[model samples]
Target: MRKLALNDEILLKIEKPARYIGNEVNSVMKDKNEVDIRFAMCFPDVYEIGMSNLGMAILYDMFNKREDVWCERLFSPWTDLDKIMREKKIPLFALESQEPVRDFDFLGITLGYEMCYTNVLQLLDLSQIPFLAKERGEEFPLVIGGGACAYNPEPLAEFFDLFYIGEGETAYDALFDAYIANKKAGGTKKDFLLKAAQIPGIYVPAFYDVTYQEDGTIASFTPNQPEAPSKVEKQLVMDMDRDYNFLEAPVVPFIKATQDRVTLEIQRGCIRGCRFCQAGMIYRPTRERDIEDLKEAARIMLKNTGHEEISLSSLSSSDYSELKELVNFLIDEFRDKAVNISLPSLRIDAFALDVMSKVQDVKKSSLTFAPEAGSQRLRNVINKGLTEEDILHGAGQAFEGGWNRVKLYFMLGLPTETEEDMKGIAHLAEKIAERYYEIPKDKRNGKVQINVSTSFFVPKPFTPFQWAPMFREEEFIEKAKIVKNEIRSQLNQRSIRYSWHEPDVTVLEGFLARGDRRSSKVILKAYEKGALYDAWSESFRYDIWKEAFAETGVDMEFYTLRERDTDEILPWDFIDAGVSKEFLIREWKQAKAETVTPNCRQRCSGCGAKRYGGGVCHEGQN
Candidate 1:
């Protein structure tokens, strides 16, 4: 029996106390004395949200599979427990061993979203570790970060010792071997980091020097250490069908996670090159798992976790070649058990409508479409492949198939957006409602329910929009009003429901996303002044961040509202994310010209992902 880090008194006082308890089903446990390395995998958010991340789950299973490495898990304690623990002076501990995280050899954090920046500081603070990497010595755990946000690690560079530049499966084994060798040789921590920096896709921020221009733009970013590479390439798994690449068993949470289901990742990377999308540009040359492998994974995962619902995880599910076969296998294999299948991010064509009819309850589920922008011209500028004809055709097919509920997603404040574009969103929603009414009275399910949602655009690194300027919060709110008023004047005003995302949160995200190394102080100052859980709406404090920025002398407008020149030295130039800067520049020019580029399937744009020698780039080739 293992003693929990939290006592019964503390457990009883906190909400969802099960979050701190370990020994959940499928969770790996190992003897500490037998293992040479102890790694604490963290997902920075609350337990429920953190457990739902498939990347963390996959990496956790991968690390624990090694006999010499005993990997555990940790999450940012909720505000209730966060205060209690601080009062009691209880160090943050890993769930598996109930040991203080400060004792671990490695603490790897997943940086999936920019909003979780403040939560990282909370974790380090609770663990009793120094906030700044340079302030820590060998006695502390080597803190590292990875995920989509790692592409722009400079904003948080001073805090993290190193960052894994890409997919966890590609380079972790080599990194671990290097660490073990260094330990056996009795090498210092700096010596081990020097060795780690030499490995592909490993970046030691402390080893590099970033010099800023007088105007605060990064003048030059070069490595000071001989071991650190001048350009760190993004790593990805070329063959996703390898048995070790996909997670075999996910740890069942004691409490229901946000994603409470069996998640089967069908593929990695996206073929559609949307100019505003970061994932599409960063994860280049999409690779998919075999259908047979997927079927086996679904079976084993469902059986192991006993989850009633299984979701197909992918950027775009419709693009997977074997989707029909896999979906059919899932339906037939588990028909007796009556398992629920979730297929998100699918094009609502005739074939997809047919699949959804079989897998989902039309009455309870709503068909979703992300047109992204309103008018065709705006869509072309953003390189969104979906057109008005496609949207209406899909919606009409869904209505005819006995579906009355529809969700349409759009982005406001996009580059080149005008009043006409803003009003076009309402016009599109009304057009979809008109399609639903086209059905005969008896044939229709009931009154149509159209839910229109719009999120303010935030420019992300490595995308064509990286050079774009974001609108102010007031301007964003005014744009939201334009759509709201347009919807009110529509013919089907009663049937449509409209909601816009809070612009304040979006502005902060933009600041974090585009900021350089100097922005780290703002995050630290914000966290020091009770800025934990900025990701959660209830706990977010825009005022706190505003004050932090003012105090730290970080002009948020410089990072968010300034449109950069094509030749400007962006903070993330040091890392190569497969897509060449030349290709991105070309796409930026194409966007300004309102030209459309074909996806990976239709035509090759020569985006430099071909260097990996795999994925759609080599499909149908020798």
Candidate 2:
């Protein structure tokens, strides 16, 4: 029998009681005396969103496989329970044992998004742990961070004890062994951090020193201690199939998750090098799994989880070498079982129609495509290899294949964007609508529905756009207005519907994304002023962040509006993401010239990922 941290009366008061209780399908339970170490794996958001992350699921399964380590799950408690926990003086607890999280050996938080910085603070506050890393003694759990956000760990450096700079699978075993050995030898926390800092991909921020110039630009970043390395090389898993185990039985949430399906990660990275995309740059030289392995994994996962829908996950699903074969196998194997198959991030031009037609969707789903930018010139600037011909031809094929609804995605406030570029979004949608109308009346399903969505672009670290300038909130709003008004003036205006995200939120995200150590003061101040769930639009208060910036006297515009000089020292310069800074600078210059670089398959632009000696870089070699 299990004793819940929350009693029945408290459970009855919360909106979702299942979120607080631990028991769910396939959740690991271990005796405290048996395990040598306890790890609290957390995603600092609500349960549903955290459960949807495939990366977290894989790492959770991997950690639990070790007999000496028992990993449990934790999420940011919702607002209703958050207030109750504070008023009742209840400490944050992990779901598995319902024990206080502060008692764990390690608290590993997956830093997925920049907007969740405040939530990270909230997680610490509720855990009854010190907010700053320096303030905590040896009694506290070693707070570590990973994921894409770890690339720019400077913004959250003061809080995290250490950051794992790359893929989770590459270095965790070594880390775990080090932690256990350090404990057996009775090492101090500082002694352990110094030892961990020497590891290939581990970064201990306290062991590094940053000196800023008079203009607020970073002057130098150097190792404070002899044990720390000058640069932390990002760890990457070379062989996708052999390096890690595919998650067979992911914890099934009691409530419906954002992505309520078994995610089959077909590949690890992307071939497309879009300048504005942090993911494409950070995850370099895509590596894919074998089709046979994926098929077997899918079968086992379906049986284990009892999930009806399965999605093929990748940076670009269509770019997988044997996608058609995999899709066909899934269709043939599960056609009678009523299992739904989905392939996201597929290029519309590349045999996408055939794959979509074969996957028998009980309800016809909308065909979605991301052009990234509306105009061809802008696309070349971003190194987006897509063309107008490619989009129209694919949309036409989809129309003939029985999809009446289409969704097109684009970004606003990209570098070198012009008024004509903004209007081109509507023009592109109009062309797609005209293609849909070409179908005969008798053959048509219904009125062609084209939903257009545009999100404000935020310059991210480790991308070609890292040094680029971003637009202000009003500028972003005016750009969206231009696109909206142009759509209204179109010949096919009735067929299209337009939507855009909050510009204020984008400004805050941009600030956090490119910010450095000084930004931590603002994040902490804002959190103290009741800033939680900034990722959720309803809970986001832009004014609180503004006041924090004013009180701290930190320049938000210095991070967002100013176009940085290439020679200036950037905060994340010391991290080697297998991509050379010289190559990124070259790409950035090419973007200014509106020149396009071919994708990885066509040619290698010498981005330095070849040093890893695997993935697409060494595809044909022994």
Candidate 3:
């Protein structure tokens, strides 16, 4: 049995004692003395949240597969335990071996969201590691960063020694072997980093110098070291069906995770090509897994974890080619065992309704639709490809199928959005309520429940909207109020419920999403002033962030609320994300013109992901 890091008394004081204890089912264990490399993998969040990330589980499995490496897991302690640990001088340790992270060979932190910036500092501080990469010497573990947030790492560049700019499955093994080779040859930290910089996907920010113009825009970004590549291209697994192990036997957390179910990823990348969506652009050239392979993987996952529910994970679940077949297979396999099958991100069309009706309880389940815009013109601008008629038709099908509740998701402040667009949201919800009444009284399952939600738009890097300007906090609130009032005047007002996201949080996310190297100082200062857990609405302090930005002389408007010229050098321009700038610029022009582009399944738009030479690019060719 592995010894617990915290004593019985200390564990009792924490909210979830299962978080600190090790020896969970399916968790790997090895003698540290027998391994050549001791790597500590961290998600920089609470254990419950971190354990649910599929990327962390994939890397953990990959790293431990090596006989010469012993990889362990660590997470940021909750604020309750954080205070106690600091006062008692308890160093942060990994769960597997109960060993201090300060003693590990390499500490890799995954940066999934921008709001977790402050929590990164907490993880470093609690581990007794240097907060700045420059302060850490050869004696300390090398701190590396990766994930979607790493696409624009300049804001947090000074803190991470290196950033992996690609899929973990494609490049991690090569990077790890290179590190092992450098270590056996008696290499220093600097020497190892210098060698690691030569790898295709590895980026050592220290080797690069960023210069800003008088207008506060990136003037020049050039490499200072010979080994560092000027443009680090994003890596991807070409043949996911053959090369990728979607999800092997992962560690079943003792505490219930946020996603406490067997998550089977059906595919990678999205063909929808929504201009405002960063994930769809970054994960280009949609690739799907074989149905047989997915079935086997799901079986293994369920067997290893004993989860009663299994969710089909994907950017667009309905876009999968074999979705109907896969859903039918799952229902046939698990329905007898009383296992719940979750199918999210599906368009509420006839096929979706048919499948959902079979798998889900019509009375309890709610139908969801992402129109992404209120008016048809705004929908065209964002390339959502969802028509108002499509919405009503789908709702009609769902209502006929005994689902009385409907949820509509839209975005406010989209580029070129007008007041009419805002009112159109309420109009659409009213129409859905009308459609619910169109059903016979005896056929209706219950009263019509139409829930409408809207969030302020925040343009992200690598997307066509990357150059678009964002609304100020007050403007966002005003727009939300406009939609709320319009909903109140609806004929079926009682049936309609409207909710909007926090404007302050939206603006803050805008600042972080598009910030450059200069914004790092503001983040550092904010964290010093108790800005941890900023992702949580209750923990976020808008005044603290404003003060930090003011003190650092970093204007939030410089990053947000300003449209950039087409030729301007963005913060994330240094990395090649497979999609060409030319394609993105073309799409941006189309967005302004309100022109719709066909998806990958219909015709190739030449987005430049084809250079990788696989996936949907050659789907019809073969």
User: 250-330 in candidate 2: lDDT tens per residue?
Assistant: 999999999999999998878889999888988887888989999999999999999999999998898899998999899
lDDT of 2: 0.92
Residue range 82-176, candidate 1, lDDT tens digits: 99999999999999999999999999999999999999998899999999999999999999999999999988999999999989999999999
By lDDT, who's the top model here?
1
Q: What are the per-residue Cα lDDT tens digits for candidate 3 across 398-503?
A: 8888988989999999989999999999999999999999999999987999999999999999999999999998999899899999999999999999999998
State the lDDT at 232 in candidate 1.
97
Q: List the residue pairs that clash in candidate 3.
A: none
Cα error, residue 48 of model 2, in Å, equals 0.3
Q: What would the TM-score be for candidate 3 when compared with the true structure?
A: 0.98
Q: Per-candidate TM vs. native?
A: 0.99, 0.99, 0.98
Question: lDDT for each of the candidates?
Answer: 0.93, 0.92, 0.90
Candidate 1 local accuracy as lDDT? 0.93
Cα lDDT, model 3, residue 301: 88
